[model samples]
Target: MKRLHYFMIVFLITGISYAQELTITGMVTEDGTGTPLPYVNVTVKRTSNTTNTDFDGNYSIKVNLGDTLSFSYVGYESEEIKVKKNDSVINVTMSIAPGTLEEVVVTAYGARKAKKSLGYVVSAVSSESISMSRSERRKARRASKKSNKSLNKALSGKVAGLTISNGVGYTNSNSSVKIRGANSVSGAQQPLYIIDGIPVNKKDIAKIQHIDPTKISDVKVLKDKKATSLYGFRAIHGCIIITTHKGNYEIKNNESYEEIVENSFEKVRTSPLSTFSIDVDKASYSNVRRMINNGQQIPADAVKIEEMINYFEYDYKQPKGDHPFAIHTEYGKTPWNKETQLVKIGLKGKEIPQDEIPASNLVFLLDVSGSMDQANKLPLLKRAFKLLVNQLREKDKVSIVVYAGAAGMVLKPTSGINKNEINQALDNLDAGGSTAGGAGIELAYKIAQKNFIKNGNNRVILATDGDFNVGMSSDKDMKTLIEEKRKSGVFLTCLGFGMNNYKDSKLETLADKGNGNHAYIDTMQEAQRVLGKEFGGTLYTIAKDVKIQVEFNPAKVQAYRLIGYENRLLADEDFVDDTKDAGELGSGHTVTALYEVIPVGVRSEYINEIPDLKYTNSEINRNFGDELLTVKFRYKRPQESKSIEMIHILKTGENKVSKDFSFAASVAWFGMKIRKSKYINNDQIKDIVTLAEENRAADNQGYRAEFVRLMNSYQTL
Candidate 1:
């Protein structure tokens, strides 16, 4: 009986211990800031069970009661907690492990490797060291007003074989960093910067200066060949790998676009004149395409029919006379509506040889805000700008200005002949902080004005996701600011990147009011297309303040409507007013517009018949009875202020339209269908597809073929 009781007691104890072996979950954060510490090691004392804190610093492990749980990080003090019977969640706060070096170091692609196993020399600065340096600097500043120092200055003596030099005539904010001395005689000597697995170009180095010192987790300097062998020739000078704390900001879907109101038919006798500013911005089409390709719902406001139609290039005759652009008009039956006719108007700018083009003084205004931390934002932007850098000439000059919490210059007016210097500056850019777009614009314009090239292309190219959260962020405010800057003779070009929280309306306003163009880059192909193949067209302006006014003949037409250009519509008087701002025409660029017209005799629901006027003359002008309509264009030379006018009269006759017209019409139809226009239905999608397929003429670039595929994909969706 005694033996049986002893065995029963042992069994009861085993059951209780097994019941206590529940999973324990908790989070590990910094001692005082409550900031989570990712990749912290967690282990059950004296057991094989072990794990590491995830990206959010959360961890889970199974342990019996009375078992000890230990948490440890490279720069943080190790922590031990004894598990109790009632303890299901154990949260730990780790203090900094002062003066302690990390046993493991982050290598290529963010993989952690033991330092002792490395074959080459690698120097590292722990988070504790960086924090301590910042603290000391703050104390010095408090003691002396002249002790103002930047992070670069604070880090000057922290690592061996690293040199930090103050940029001449610039503040400490522009300090240059070099690792293990200069590696090249003529190339850039600054070490290549890597942030969270993304290689930053040198031009964006200023952005790294803006990062908060406290947010930096680690900084490693790789000095020898074996240390930087994985990074390639760009890292010949060495590499600086920095790991930062994961931001607390969450991704939110808050994309915005300007609302579009479709154009309605108007009677020729009542509203005969149709006036609007020409639009060369093709951002809307690519943005919409990105949405469709991502399988996201297409917003109605995102569809700009005119931009969609103009996205594809059309074949038009070259300008033969004194005009900078050649005008071509075509008349044909409308594909969407049999009762209405389509009038296609196209303008092709004169193409200039690259060598003959004027010297360019370009300022790159880049946004390095927290929102741009994604791969498609800053990384892709760097690659895209490199393509443009490759195309620069010896006579041209380039400057770089970046903005985050504030604006600062990363590179001065460096000649394009020094491509290495320019590319090195581009490589150092890192993304963080709030966007100060207004401040960036002001600074970019200042740089462009300071380095103004006479009779040359002086422009500021703004690349961003358009998520301006600080200082003058509203669309109206941006418009006002850009309008004031336009007087400086420095044009603006807005290149939008990324999605979700994208502010299209604000970018559009900036481009429109600043006398420039806008384009959205969704892929590297698009980047090549915009900044590569079409470099001349994307930068050089041929004409400014270009406007179009059309007068429909009452004798030949009853009513007409202009497709798209809802926000670009101008008062009839604005067409002749040179003081009013309008669209710009770039070299080698083409612009297209379409009008749907209803004849005087056709009965249509788009128009209502009115009784004959009693006092007005209802008789048609017999002298110009054969005339269909008249088109008048007003434009100013790139340097001229006064407007030059040109007129063309289209006569009423049977005309055969080219494949360009059919293709453009098809694009407009597809846009309308996507927008769910009241006049267009799903049934017409087939016709649009067929028309586009048939008119895919000489599609050397295969852009038309891509469009056909897009249409077919949309049909299934």
Candidate 2:
């Protein structure tokens, strides 16, 4: 009996030992060179647990006793090892797979191609080298406070034929990288940068000062004509492609967007009036396009139907009378549901010639925080601002204020004619430290107020990812500050950049409260559209506090639902209250709004049954014969205090619509489908695509065509 008890106790103890979980830590290195490989995928055999090596090739994963861990990396042999009873650490040494050199090569757009398939020489640097260099740089920075080594500088001796030169004139802190030497005499000579499949503008190459070297899996330099041709004419200098361990795109994103609540059908007999602020900002459309192009999941809140509809220019007539904008209305059968009717309201601000536009006092409030260190943020911003600066005239004045840990004035008020000086100040800027956005805004507003130009276009252009970590960073705080500053006659322009950690909600609030506009610059093409081609429209606000109020006639309508602008909805009394804040209309800008309506005697699943009123009469008045709706608009001149009102009347008649109306409806439908609205379904997406394609009128800029292509791409996804 004693022997049997001892055997059972031993077996129980052994079972407990086998069931115990242990954290296995290790370093993965190349066998021959003994160099640490970053982002080496380590997975537990048969289990879902996995991890990747850090910058120093260190990794840790939890596993049970007798479990096996596998280490795998591209172009290298994979290995697996079993955990022993007493094992706590496991170090792996990987060797290059046979013929790896000829079998694989990293190419542009994060695609891998056979080395022999490319005609030009493709120089490559392993992540191990980058990690080692970064570690050394960090140690050096800690030892010497003045050391400001950048990723470009770290690659000086790593790749053959790649030259690194420290920038001259504006800032010695900036470094420029060249693959095959200077190929252009006037234009940018640096090679185009491709990070995680997204192309960074070549002109912004110098702004690519810093990146988290730990996240980089590998870097490849594509030199020579054949290789450069893949990226178009802009890649004349060459191309540098950096791939991350997260595959072609970063998945650990912290992008924030405001919540959107879809509008429900309202009973016209009870709620006849629908009021909202007119929105001209098109940031949502472009931002959504960026997400789609990156092959990322589209956030429902990111699809603002109104913005998407307004993104394309409409064929509305310009204002001829005293009004600053012209209004047009159309009624048609709903494309998605035949039981419902669609109403489209369009507004076109009068266009002003560039020379005729008012002179300006501009304050550039730039975020130089650590979050903006990515190639797409600060660097892209610099290139974008350069385009705006090139359009400035002699009468314009400019000042620059940057915030990173603290706020400071980089350039005093200077004439816009001094383009070289302004450009120099912009080029000297670099990204580092925490964001102090509120402090920066206070300083920028102070500067703008001090140099306030009466009757002139005075504004602050804030460029950031909206990740404000230090000092008064909340949305309410920003809104309050902007609202107070707008009383001083200084408007705001919020230009957003970057992807991860983007604070879209805060930026939108700042723009909405400060009598300003907001736009997200996702690429050089978008930058050109916002800052170059539409310079006057972007800088000069023709009207402010624009609000729209529509009263549906119960005789012609039963129930109605506004398509978008959920955030812009205002109280009915706010329509007539000049104290209430609304949207600003830029010169030459267009705004469009859509409404889904259930005509009299028509039924829709969107409408919910409501009990009859107890005391009030809910009957339709036939006295308003054939009247569909009455639309009233209120707006203030840029320098005025009181508001001007305009009215337009629509009558029920034949449902004739323009191509613009059809296209706008199609965009709205697409937006609804993406937002997963109950009003739209996947089956109708094909119809939406066909409608967009059919109504794509003389699309001079090819934006409509691009939308069609995006629709097709989305279907495939």
Candidate 3:
């Protein structure tokens, strides 16, 4: 007891001494522009302490007196300072240090290289203009507001073929920035944005309204095939590479927020149950379509086989009883590999007619910041809303809300019948100021609640480039706020428009968490397809919190792998947890998922064989008898808390392949080909085209024909 007391006393003294040390906090900015640089590496030289700047370019670190500190950033000279006993603040201003080999320029993934080495056509706007020193950035920020200056105006005519149009954006940021021209049919034409080695979407940029223009160290555009080939399909439309100022300290983020988990084949004996959230979102398909249409190769990571298969409607019977959706399952020989089998699970929501659908209480949350001034942004949004307004009945109500520097209600909850009033209000909205997306969401939700319709559809239709640059811009905060707002029975519909910095990932999260659907409107036709042709399907939710689980038979299957749905993959325990949220299904919406299974006698190089366990040599149960797998589904009605369950089983038999099934297989095959998947052994693009052509049924919408054209375009490339 005496020893323990002595140790405790010593520990207390040490803790107190450590606590007395000073913590230094400061903003790291470019030396000349005073623009804060994010992700700057700051480290206490000899000590292990280190930290990176946040999005705001601010950092805080704890250090003792006499501790030497080092600050460093890419493309900038390194600096070191010694901490004084009384020091509480240490602001750093780093100087530019371009790469040594030839004239250097920042490129995709924050790579700095000599321009002469690149074989592609490259253009660069350096720190001298894009991001000056701290003081210059402030002056630029103020001047931009005074003159209503934007990224588009500043960059116009600077790069030979680059075109930046006035569109929805923060007053402090650029409008829609496009390089060269549109090469993709469905993919965004804007260059992918990279800041401090992070690929940020337009919405990510929009969330921060006060970014110092000088923080943008350099902006480079890769126009030729050779320059963008490294980036895969995402760069096919052209690549706009950006490098932001950051510290050079050794920072650590072992667990990145946006990391993708690569799916691996699971051994049935070790883990037989495969569980995942049902993903009804088709954004992946549209995004990939954009890339393919642009004549760019598709990024392997972007090719979600599930979304691609689900993008097109499949012919399945509607649910007969109390359930809102029907579940269908089939097993067949794998088209890609004869040794393996393919398992498909499909769900079809009940279709509801316009007359039978509930009246809607819609809050049109329009983003009218300077970035949205482009013809494709606010103008297109106005036209899209008009199409939706035209669908509204006398019983439906609508409200107009616009957000820029602030959020405000432009039109009160007026009858949808008053189309003229809504149109007028929409026309009056002009672009300027910063983006206050959080504020706009709050006000819109408040208005939606004030005029709550107990049994009607209350929803917020947010149309923007997904750029929010004011308060509550962080993804975590935005997600929490949206999740909270969804409890008010107000669903969300995110309509992404324009390009250059488009936040496809952010919008996807908003839609998934808000119990809504997300669609990118690249043209008027897409708007018509989403808001017009699929009105009931896009707006009305038939089933919510949908989850799917499949149990593979160890006796018949060696290993299995699910294709795509990486973000939607869930733990087995989550399948039965009603409190967890999953994807939603709208009226008449169809969802499909596919799995590749290695048969018992087949040897798949993709499957890793684990050595026998040390403890239990569990025997494989063979009682199931030729059963391939048992699929179970769980879903809840839109407003329900509990969930209903359904099950289906598959067995080994002579494969019965239909035209629809073959078409789905062809689509999957095409996706794999574009992705250049290592798992696609012996599959060829010609085979995919042949299968698609042979299975192309009554091509009414010409969708299959368009796909054929896209496939043909890819073949040429």
Candidate 4:
């Protein structure tokens, strides 16, 4: 999906370039003084497509053989020209009529776009000024307080209505955007960001998550309600259009495998893993023996247990250490103290390069719901797929299945390596009807199965707002149905679109049950980052039914609980039993998890002063320093029938403290404080921020500055 998007710039630009098309190149000038009309806008008529004249009023445009071109400038009368297959260049001298140059401006409320165009927003960024910043100073406002003092300085003057203010840190989380000022105070106001037209997830917007911005060519902000209406409800907060120049518009694929090759780290523990024992909550099973051992009470209603659990926070351990590339870590600071600590880990072993990843059969299950008429939903879906189409290799295939009032195939299994045919299919998509989500999923899966990849990635990528109101609507029923199909080897990746009817939970179910991942496409940069660049991780699967179990040592830790991954927990028995299912892992993907531990001596609310008499017969206490916990992982080889297990012990005080983990812990701590999680202290935000900054590393240091900026903006709170 991502690779195709990068390819589209090529497909869209050159897609017509090689189409036996006509090139209309000429110089515009006044008939008398022969003065150049610099910056005059030229449009290819019927299509609101356009570009501007250069300083010398020289212009070059690509058009189909029989298309007509239109020309306009602030003070020039607009002219139209028709071109044919054999005509190469066309030149014209302008005769300006008085008052003919009235500028056309689009405005409605606080939003603005040229009334001359519609479909997607005209959000744009200067081509010559593109910069590579880890924490993309999303707003022109103060990205860092130390450098840009005023909040307005970071992002204010640059993007209209796009404000990037808050504190001075990487994870302020509070910094916000109100595209047209509070459309709905209760809903997310961040505009839908379309890169070349695909929606990207908001959480993936940080500097280090994924995608290299250096590959990006331009950015467009779709702000006005009109600009966003293509996606209907999702555009309540507006939208952004991002176009990566990888394949289109002459942006060379600048980053080589070596350059984009992420720095690697040493595994904190890589010994041959040990096996784990399973433990299920008493009520979760029907195993008569285990039930009797625990003396559990039976329930009248069926629990209808999931065959395999697809929880999100199994805390896969990354190889923790400084990058072997440059050794970025400070000698004294442990992994636990750095503000923006990055545990750069690559695949346990190379599977395949991005370009060389296996052929895939992709079925895009799109929801063209009534709520999706706003700019970001259906429209972005088309744009995003077009971007994905641009990246296809000869072996890749694509199929699009759209559902709203009824389900139907817009395009069959066609090679993504092919463009025009796919674009024609995409160009015809229109949004209407109630969401018949379940029907769409069924059709998509059917299409994917028809083009199923043998020993490759075969998946249905569902893009929708998840409002399955029309038929087969219950989420659980849909989940159960999808789960059964995943056994057939067709994975799923759920892409959520629209805001008012956005169902994160439902999309989550599909991704989990269907052996895939969920990402919210809120921007095009995100789409490029995901589909164009990280195509393998986005498409290929290396491991399936991945489960992790951490058994804490009761002796060393008094009380402890994992945080955030409420959805990812596994019963201990499920961890070892080959038959029990778990989450799937993509090649070279990184998953993180954290735990808030209350050490043995820090007694307060966690411990019960009086022990329960039920356990009075316990033996004498032993060593408390052996191990804090043993980390166990169970997963099926990307090419296996059963699961395999690996285990490592994580002892308390075993951390050979690196500033990276400490800083990351601080950042996560900041998030806990911001979201006001149960364990974090509001009063301690300042201290945590200070700790993160003080422990920050010198390598790729911009993230630290961002963290500081976020802190400054919210420290007052």
Predicted structure with the largest lDDT when compared to the true one: 2
Candidate 3 residue lDDT tens string, 236-273 = 66766655566221122111123345567899999999
Candidate ranking under TM-score, highest first, comes to 2, 1, 3, 4
Model 4, CA-based lDDT: 0.55
What TM-score quantifies how close candidate 2 is to the native fold?
Answer: 0.69
lDDT of each: 0.83, 0.84, 0.76, 0.55
Candidate RMSDs in order? 20.3, 22.3, 24.7, 20.8
lDDT of 2 by residue, 244-312 (tens): 778554334677888999999899988999999999888999899878765678989988888888888
Model 1 residue 524 distance off true place after TM-score fit, in angstroms? 0.7
User: What TM-score quantifies how close candidate 4 is to the native fold?
Assistant: 0.54
lDDT by residue (tens digit), candidate 1, 1-717 = 999999999999988976677789999989889977655778887554666664456788889888888786655667899998888899999998665232222233355678777676778888777774646656644633232244565467999988887666523335668886535544458787777666665445656654555667778888787755566556778888787777231223678999998998999987899999999888888888778655578889988888888789998888988999988898898888888899988889999888989999999999988788776688778888999999999999999999998999999999998989988998899886779999999999999999998899999999999999889899999989999999999999999999876788989999999999999987666787899999998999999999999999998899999989998999999998899999999988999999999998998888887898999877767688889999999999998999999998888787888999999999999988888877652346778899999999988776787788678768766
TM-score of every model versus the real structure: 0.67, 0.69, 0.66, 0.54
What's the distance in Å from true for residue 397, model 1? 0.5
User: How many residue pairs clash in all the candidates, one count each?
Assistant: 15, 0, 48, 94
For model 4, residues 28-112, the per-residue Cα lDDT tens digits are: 8876879766556677865635556644567888788768877765445567778866677777677765632112211111223
